[model samples]
Target: MDVRLLEKEGFAGLFMRLRAEGLADKPLLAALEQTPRTLFVSAAHADAAYQDRLLPIDCGGFAESADLVARLLSLLSLEPGQRFLDVGTGSGFLAAVAARMVERVVTVDRYKTLVQLAQQRFAHLGIGNVIARQADGLKGMSGEGAFDRIIATCAFDSMPRAFVEQLASGGVMLAPILAEDGRARMARLTKIGSRFEREDLFEVPYRPFIPGLAAAL
Candidate 1:
């Protein structure tokens, strides 16, 4: 068997499945194949790294599946020379995958443990463009300048007004929003001048966004 083909067999299978379901795009597939998801997978659940399943990480959080990550990223339509903000660094798998496609990435997580672990992964993998820090993502981090694209890994009710306002004009944000009716769905908000165009996408099973930073854990 060809070694290159063997390396892609993992997400490569997922890439084809997502493509058939209209979820995968070519560039994202390439990026996924290049990124080592195993490095970010929690040791206890490393088996799910490239298996199209959410991996259980530390601090009771979950790392989204490669397919879900690719689907959300495709919605962002990321471009070169773009500064992206990732809310909820988690295991930093998504941020690592994204770093290859953008100019820079600022990813924030509430848990200090997650932040420290993720930073170590980024350094081990030689991923320098991502800035992983512990912060309150609900309010958005300040002094980072404007972002061309942003993505939240968790679910929220209503909109993240602070993050919406921080986007550069014409910037795009991808997040999962929950409604009062108990229905939750993914949404893409594109900022055009002073207003935002909200487009709700598929239903998702993401953890609700928590406010404030983790005092411990």
Candidate 2:
């Protein structure tokens, strides 16, 4: 077997387990397969990109694991032509994967370096529908409201009021909400008739949404 083909199979085999574990939504899987995880992380961590563990990214933050990211997305009922908003753009990996599954994705981060790095990765992949910028994300991108879907890569004690308000009527949001004990649990919120129905999904170790942009990083 060719060395490159063997490497390809190895990576494919790792992702296959996600299918067996029931994270096998077709469009989500296709998005994952389409984006190369290695492009989102530094070369030192490229070899571990397919593993289910958070990887350190620039600006002293971490990117959620590929497994967790896939699982979180699998829970989202993603559809084509839906406008998506991603908060806490960290490595931009989540936004990159999602850009493949939706019409347009606007991702925000607190660090300028992270945004720039993610933008480069998106361009390298020829992904054009993502609008990444440096922002606090507590209020989401100004004037980008009423999105079809919203996802926050970090955890919040409660769904930011602004985010829920920004979700279009009948739209869905996937985020991590902190429990009393401070562990973050995945929560799914659906906008219905000006009210949101919340469903706590599962426990996760995602970091909190840092409140401000880096002044000098």
Candidate 3:
């Protein structure tokens, strides 16, 4: 990948677009500048790498929605050296970007083939701080609620109870929350004591949350 191309052209355009959309952020723009989105998926879609469009990947999944991905990452408000849990970790595109800013990323997907392919991509990229696993997204990652951040690429009819339970206090859960009318709304929820404060960020269209996944949320 031509790393300079992102800084020289891709990110420049991304910044302008984000600013016009009222979505600009320094950290996310930096991430967009540093991470080569083309490296995350098949060569067939390479031409569309920085076009701000979602592309198809394995397991009938679409790489994180382009604008949504950027905005979602920004909303997570990730800091350097933090740990992030990525549920529905698709092509590892978001995880790859996360690895650049965070200390480590624990990403899980329910699809075995996707996990294998994503792991291969991670290895090819020489990324060592990410653990990509094929596990039920609703089950949530175990261990002491130690993550500093958590985000799900998929959208759920309701917030997953497991995600809320596993979230560390003061940590945020970024997800697409499906409204009663079935429209997806981008949101960020912060765990506070035993309760969570959900904030709707924007409207979005996403692949539905996994089957039975909403029931548990």
TM-score of 2: 0.93
TM-score on alpha carbons, each prediction: 0.92, 0.93, 0.86
Q: What is the C-alpha RMSD of each candidate to the true structure, in Å?
A: 2.5, 2.0, 3.9
* Pairs of residues clashing in candidate 3: 160-217, 161-217
Q: Against the true structure, candidate 2 has what lDDT?
A: 0.83
Q: Name the weakest run of 10 consecutive residues (lDDT summed) in model 1.
A: 1-10
Segments of candidate 3 deviating more than 4 angstroms = 1-8, 22-24, 211-217
TM-score, candidate number 1: 0.92
Per-candidate Cα lDDT values, in order, are 0.83, 0.83, 0.77
Better of 2 and 3 by lDDT: 2
Residue lDDT tens for model 1, 126-191: 989999989988877788999999998788887776776789999998878898876778888899
Q: Which stretches of candidate 1 lie over 4 Å from their true place?
A: 1-7
- The per-prediction tally of clashing pairs is 0, 0, 2
Candidate 2 pairs with clashing backbones: none
Question: Whose TM-score is greatest here?
Answer: 2
- Worst 10-residue stretch by lDDT in candidate 3? 208-217
